[model samples]
Target: MLLPIALAVVALGACDTGGPQIPEPPGPEQPTTPSQPSTPQQPTTPTPPTTGTTGAAAPPGTIAYARGGAIRLVNADGSSDRALWQVPNASLAATIGGLAWRPDGTELAFSSDHEMATSWYERDIYVVSADGARLRRLTNAPALDALATFPKGTVTVRVQNLTGDAGPYFVYVLGAPAPQQVTIPAASSRALTFTNVADLGNVAQPVVVINGTNRWFGDAVADVQGGRSVDAGSLVVTAFGGIPHYGADVPFWRADGQRVGFIGSPTCNLMQVAATPPAGPSQSRLLDPAVFGATCAVDWGPTAATADQIVYVDERRFVDAGEVQFFRVAESARSAGSPLLTVGRYPRITDVRWLPDGSGFLFARTNDLLDQAVNIHEYVFATKAERQITNFTGSFVRQFSVSPDGQQIAFERVTDLKGPSDLWVVRRDGTGARLLVRDARAPAWNPRLR
Candidate 1:
């Protein structure tokens, strides 16, 4: 159950104003002893809605979302509005975790309930067509399975059982069908080992996997451990977890797979691995530390491009005010090299994603610390501006996604603190706000394949 709004007042204290505050106006002049038996007060006039540069009508190619077991797409610009597809007996039990569109945009990959309970630990990977037709169950596992990426010819999934007694808790790769037990040796079970996988595609050919034993490569078990491997590209560098106490969620490879970036804990300094995998002994060097102050979350820009800028939130003030800060990763390794830019400082930065073109990204910001009313914001990089997309009074925006062309935005508008969440969408400019699907969490936009 979510805490009531009144509780937020006590939790955040009076000093922490979540949103804009309203000032009290001066009281009326002292009246002469209730003159004329207090004449009836006149009703205040209602304020007219202010229209921005974009009018009330939705922009061209606009989409609205609703929630009802599955993601429902509605053509707000037209009359056809209905459920895209139903996941049979899918329940709103567990929250949908993450979503991504295949390069071709014909299919969508997402993480949902792998286990039975509503807890975060129980989740599995599922895929569906763009039009909501042909729902496919990709992974049939009792443990938690998440679809990390579905690159054209192959799909990569991360399966783990933190609570299970079993020893095999790692990520696996599957090439369509046939060989279902394809496991990365670096990520194989070996007591308590930690591994992080990043995709560089075929350009770097072999994917980069950071494991506890040692960083090595090979498609098969023998090639990986025995060192019988071909040079996919240059050996950028090697990054090791710092202290290992804070856990591993740091290192990430750039979209182009040319450079690797990660955060070194204990010191929490931002470091970059410049070597391409499958090369000479891995070499590592520290990058800018100023941009990586107590980093909380980090995401690589889109691949297929050279823009190596990474966005992350500083942990310094995030503990109290939940502010989000953005930094641009430049080539220079100077001390004052990285510049920290402030995107928004209010509420909390929930999720951050980079646009395919590296132009800008969309992020989910919420104010419901105790689960009372959620506000969503769309941050545009080109204009260097942030706009409040959803203004649900007593609900929270669970998860959201942006269209392939970056025109439409879909999200789950969760009402009733203890109830299920529904899917909704609004124009990036805050127009044509409506419900598209119900009982859905993570929504991914399908790319328009040629």
Candidate 2:
């Protein structure tokens, strides 16, 4: 699912997103009156640029979704969908944030309510077996221990947006005896590498790959060992008039762990920053100056060609047609970036993610103003074909998460009523449809996890 916090980086009332750093909907204290029409309809889904390429067909591993107060996993086709685990406090009506599969494919990591705090604000990280046994709390505190991604092992790197306004990005390492926390200040270099775990009493520590422009702290390992608290302040920088240097959108980190990319605050242009070595120097530059009013979706991992290679979507909504262009950049290459794909015309295309094998990507196509219905599409790199993955009407297709193997998908089904969201699973080939639960937020397939 394209989470408000995970993929929906920032939320502007007019451009309000669903990211974690986005502050809660302003309370009644703040008042505003805008031009109104007879219809008081909910915000409609936005359009996504069209992808010329297409293809489809496939299947795989157990898919995990949310229902009631439990995290459930079903077979690829949605059959055998059973409860893997449930939040201990059923009365809390806890909301699941994001789900990540362990590298070996035995356990899953996710963010959910740790207790009955009476608010979604109190979320924590957790790990569970594929069958729903041995549930362990990875984090137990009030802070938001959100966003857990397993690159390729028992290790999971979690991202914490300390400030509600997208301030500091507190990067945490899980799957370790004691998870480590470090803060990357606003504008820190796109790349922040976490290494040298020998000093921290661990034989091997998972590499913490993070992206941003300005990093004030580099020695997070030593700090973690020394018992230091990362005070991820807040975002408070403005360059062009009221444009902020740091917006609510999340930074894009390449799966290769070589570089990180993000949107320039005031300019809205895309910037690529080096994933600086632990406590070392790095560089920051624009991926494309021509792409203005743009922000990145997520890292679909690197192409098989090289670690520097990355496939990302650029949203340039300022132009008359609102272009959503896809580019694959190889830092070592002389060319600024290789333009891979672009939305047909007008309507914006958002939420583009790489398939498991990196051969293609999945995305949603919606009309401008996001009012009309949405259709999910998949593009195959090998075939240069674009195939429609879903068929729905009226309501929108919130988002889709691909499994590690790239055969099956877990996606969100949204309606205008603001009612409970439905969680569904479909094969990559677009067959075998089934609903796992209702009202779940983020649904991620277990990648190859141990």
TM-score for all models, in order of appearance: 0.45, 0.51
Model 1, C-alpha of 344: deviation from truth (Å):
7.8
Per-residue C-alpha lDDT of model 1 across residues 268-351, encoded as one tens digit per residue:
344443322222112133343333354434566664553445665554545566544666554342433333455433545545
True-structure RMSD, every candidate: 17.3, 14.5
Best by lDDT: 2
- lDDT per prediction? 0.38, 0.43
For candidate 2, give the lDDT. 0.43
lDDT of 2 by residue, 80-129 (tens): 65667877767775566456555455666555544313111234345567
